[model samples]
Target chain A: MNRFLKILFFALLVKPMVLLGLGLNVFFKAKLPKQGPAIVVANHNSHLDTLVLMSLYPLSQIHKIRPVAAADYFLKNKLLAWFSLNIIGIIPMQRKHIRDTSALFAQCHRALDDGDILLLFPEGSRGKPEQLSDLKRGVHHLIKSRKTLKVVPVMMHGLGKALPKGEMIFVPFNCDVVVGDAIPFNADAKCYIDSVSNALNQLLALCMTRQSVVKDDLE
Target chain B: MFNIPIHSFYMMTFVVILLITGSLIRWRLQVKNPQTDYLELKQRIQSWWWMIGILFGILLAPTTVSIIFFALLSFLALKEFFSIMPTRQADRRILLWAYLAIPLQYYWVATNWYGMFLIFIPIYVFLFLPMRAVFIGETKGFIRSLGTIHWAVMLSVLCVSHIAYLLQLPVKNEQAGALGLVLFLIFITQFNDVCQYIWGKTLGKHKIIPKVSPKKTWEGFIGGVITVTLISGFVAPYLTPLTMVQGFVAGTLIAISGFVGDVVISSVKRDLAIKDSGTLIPGHGGLLDRIDSLIYTAPLFFHFLYYLHY
Candidate 1:
């Protein structure tokens, strides 16, 4: 019943809302990994970002995709935790002070081991609207030891204006999602993190150009 | 039982034949040339099939269904308009209101409330949007934001809604009712576009507006106008209440206005420096890109028909 509900939820609600209600123009869609054992990292802006990313995949692959979300925020309340876990299938990560950091990513590592695709927002939290903030090291930490892991960077534009961080009144906006080629895992943490940031920045630049052709027309 | 008019049946049959012929030609061309790039033509035919399929569904469905379909079209167009054109953060709520006005405007047309349909976007929504933006208290780029938002709504919603309003007109002539008029407007406008492209590609020499629309040529413009005018004269008598001469005049107006509409959108795209409006349609670029000519011809044709027949 839970499995049926998940498919039904994504097929009936999430897909239509993301694909139809808020139009998405995905560029380089061929770059999105078809299978699991991959990390799809994107610059987070609106809550819709996760849904948008998940909706990009086929419904049959819903169970194979797990978004790595901050545990405290999504799991603060019982209802949200239940919905996030069962419905969204988010792999909750502990962001607070921790004695052993490896324990925090155990679930993620297991999911990867199981060949499940994990979605990560390396910005830690939804930053100021559309602005990209500093990259969190959690992604680098998660993949530093996993040399063969495939990490894809996706940059989304205009979703922040659609829903943003706090405002609930949903306004329709055309969003552009550009997917970048997979980045090879680096043993050096900073180098890997910089590579991820650079990849994301390039994807973001692609999204910007995709929306506005006239350079000076953009504010 | 679907109460589809007889004329619509004929139009559908004609479209079927047109598509079959188009496909056959593409196949023959491929077989002969074997190496020519037909990707654009292939995409166009595919998109046309889908578009015509949707049109058939709309025509066969009930009044409410058609209204909702056009409403969805307006929403998509307006979304594309906003998606390409820049908008300030302050007018977010105003944009919401701008979207809200679409349904209300269409509702007026559905109810056959002419007073509200004519004035809602131009008068009420126009004044309300700017005032609502003022409440946001960000005076930065005030005129720029207001002008963009207002013009976007007017073009995407107000202008496009005229097509839907054609459905609401009371039938004066049994030969061609409101649906016929709607069909005549759309068919002729699109026919004008196709003819213009063919004429331009075949005999285009003099550039009409090289900066705005590079593909457009004087030969194409004059050739398309003449073809559309002659064709409209023949088709309008069956699809609309206009006689041969009146149809000729209407066709001339639709042909000229369609060109203007096409060029106007070209200028807008040129200003934005974007190639297409949005990626809604596969071969046709975007919904706005496809309907740009219709946006101008719809209202002009509607008012022309209204003033004459009604």
Candidate 2:
């Protein structure tokens, strides 16, 4: 009976937050990756994208969606440290430190080998909503190093409007998440990075186009 | 230590009936807009489950254990309250007092010292809180810091300590008066929330205060009050020291006070431009979201019962 109540309590608490995110997905018609052991590369718009992605997938798949957040931002305090490691299970990467590059890449590789989904923002940092930032080399190393892994480009639009950088408030707005087909990769390091970056740009453009169409319909 | 009584069984039955009727009504309403309505219904079910767990803990757990549980909840709720509202570095000493005052207040309740419990915050802490700030010697924004700390101490420490105070009530045969009272307030207050939402969604027409809470409607408010009154009129005889009419009136006051509490917290969130206090609870937004209605209802209900029965 105690176990049953514990499970019931968790369901009640987790479902609403998940549904809020899922509601955003339904409104935007979010497309999620169909397979696992893939790298989900999305534009860094806002904090809501992580939840949007988690809600778009099933609970079984949620555990596999390991969001790679900057260590400095997420691990700054004890409370946030617990939330990131235990609640969200984020993969902490040292964004500012060049010395920790190899260790971070190894961690990503371990996650892939364990059949987990890796969520990476290729831009390395949040940028202006209108344009994509230059792709970071982390994506390049992850894809080329692992031959079996797939690279799926995801574009999250309107999260900047929903909750932007340095803003505490979150306005309810239509945010779109588009998951494109996997970009094929080979062992060639340079080619793999270029191909993934190009695919990500294309997916982002599609998201922008879809957002405009939505705006037209609303108007 | 399990000291489950016959009354515990009665409370369990009451909760079960509430869950069934509430869930059935909520589920039945989702025929039109299935997605959003379904989500809302799911949240209601989850809230009910939490309510049951808390009720069970209060009823079955040992006195020491339950008091600790209430203390922990007060600490968290108080922490969440202060985190959202702006505070100054100068207010640090007052916050230290706030944390220290929680255990001491609950100690008064646990020992059944009604007089000390009542005046601990209003008389003693009230006088000392500002003095602690004065010692800091930072007069810059002094009034604002003092006001914020005083409000926090009142709401988080004084208001919530009433739950502990209920545990101290002396009844014939040393019956579970405190537990019953706590259970009574929690059940009626949260049920008011559920009934109001259900009532508003169905028969709602005119918005009560569209600027403060767009979802609240007069139809829902009336329906919620009537339902809570009817339920309390029947249930209070068993769970509380009040007569039938007194219970009904108490329930009505709870519904009204709960509505104000919900709106007041919503206004604060609006000022901060955030949604859902924090993401601690699943269906509920945060600890604050779950307890927003209780902030006013707990204190009011305690005082009402205290004056009449104690």
- Who wins the DockQ comparison? 1
**lDDT, candidates in the order shown:** 0.87, 0.71
Highest TM-score against the true fold, candidate: 1
Give fnat of each prediction, in order: 0.35, 0.00
Worst 10-residue lDDT window for candidate 1 chain B reads: B1-10
What is the TM-score (0 to 1) of candidate 1?
A: 0.95
By how many angstroms RMSD does model 2 differ from the true structure? 10.8
Tens-digit lDDT string for candidate 2 (B1-310): 2554445456767788877887777767776567664775588587767767775766567776777777767776665555455555345456667777888988887787778988998999889988888887877677866777678678777887777667666752224355777778888888899899999999999999998889999999999999998998887877777889989889999999998888988887776565765545667766778888888999899889878876
Candidate 1's displacement at residue A205, Å, is: 4.2
For residue B202, what is the lDDT in candidate 1?
A: 100
How well is each residue in A1-219 modelled by candidate 1, as lDDT tens digits? 777899999999999898777898788999999998999999998999999999999989998999999899999999999999999999998888555779989999999999999999989999777778889888888887787888999999888878878788888988889999999887788888899889988887655324422223234
How do all models score by TM-score?
0.95, 0.60
Per-residue lDDT tens digits of candidate 2, residues A1-219?
433442343356445543442223232234355566778887786777776766666554566778888999999999989777766668998877767667767778788778788899878777654356777777877665566666777776656654556766543333456677777776666676677677766765544223221121122
In candidate 2 chain B, where is summed lDDT lowest over 10 consecutive residues?
A: B169-178
